[model samples]
Target: MFKLAGQLASDCIVLGDFQLCTLLLMNDAQYPWFILVPRREDATEIFQLSVADRSLLMEESCLLAEKLKDAFAADKMNIAALGNVVSQLHVHHVVRYRKDHAWPAPVWGKSPAVSYTPELLNERIGKLRAVLTNGFTFAESCP
Candidate 1:
């Protein structure tokens, strides 16, 4: 069985799951940031996955990046899998804008995370749920 990292559960809103990964929306309202965590136990690196699992992860990641880029109209899409903090095999897909608070630089440690209001949070979730179709399932409730 696989359990979500404690930090991730606290920091992100559970969007839903793909075939092999659980999709999470970072609670920060500053940017449209999302994470895809493989539903594998004790795996902290992509290389740890079996060959088929690695291929599936890449497919899921690309689908997510494309959908996010179109949905957010992002100037650039930043995707990475740095597990320095949370040692879970998760990939980040951040939608960036040229005029964003930390343009031309990584979003990490640049500024404090701006949390989402109730209404905005709902809107963001709804928007994402609408676009993330074809093998994506929306979580009935967030944890």
Candidate 2:
């Protein structure tokens, strides 16, 4: 069975699931954002996924973007697959707006990641975990 891996950023809220992916929110408050980490073992490229999985990943990304839109009222969404710092195969879906701090520019390097306060972190996690646990389930089919 596929063992669910640990979250890279636990401070972020739990958005939902992508089946083979784990959807995470950035707690930085820098942007209304989410990250998708496929549960595959040691996959470094999107092409590593089977054709079916590749399609599903795209769908999952869309779902995360939509959820962020509704919850955060994001103006625009940015989806990226850059593996610069962390080598793990992860995708980032950042919600953007014209009036945002880093308008018209990529979020990376524009500002540092904002760490959530302890109380806020717990509260946010609670809210998101409730939504995600209610709306999503992880079925272990393989390791």
Candidate 3:
């Protein structure tokens, strides 16, 4: 009964699914970004989920943040769940560097997204998938 929101599908690359959420890579070349979307239907806020689901979401979010930070060797990690545009229960994990274009500023609205080419996108996905599978088993098929 779960379906990905249209904006999300168009903007992110499907990484895979976990026990309670789907992992997606934000299609922006400026940063190593990822999103975790809870699979509950019609849920908008974190508290809307069952207790077990809330716990699982936190666990997954932390795991992703740790791995992404290390993999990208990022200076900092920006993780948030601001569902202002897309009213779905989703969390974002973005690896940031001190010298990045937006640097000290947030990665949103500062500049337009720089999409990845097919070859580059695949390379990024492969690296992320490797990092994820090292710790957790994916529920959906992974590349």
Report, for every candidate in turn, its global Cα lDDT versus the true structure. 0.92, 0.70, 0.87
TM-score of each: 0.96, 0.74, 0.92
* Candidate 3 C-alpha error for residue 136, in Å: 4.7
- The residue-by-residue lDDT of candidate 3 on 1-143, one tens digit each, is 88999999999888777788898888898888889999999988999999999999998888888888877889999999999999998999999999999999999888999998888877777777668775455546444
Candidate 1 per-residue lDDT, tens place, 1-143, comes to: 99999999999988899999999989899999999999999999999999999999999999999988888899999999999999988999999999999999999999999888998898877778778768998888952
Best TM-score among the predictions, by candidate number: 1
Comparing 2 with 3 on TM-score, the higher-scoring candidate is: 3
- Candidate 1: minimum summed lDDT over ten consecutive residues — where? 124-133
- Model 2 Cα lDDT, one tens digit per residue, 31-116: 76668888788777899989998998888777667766665567888889987766678898887888999999999889888876
Write out the backbone clash pairs for model 2. 2-142
TM-score of 3: 0.92
Clashing pairs in 1: none
Report residue 1 deviation for candidate 3 (angstroms).
1.3
- Rank all candidate structures by their lDDT, best first, as comma-separated numbers: 1, 3, 2
- What order do you get sorting by TM-score, best first? 1, 3, 2
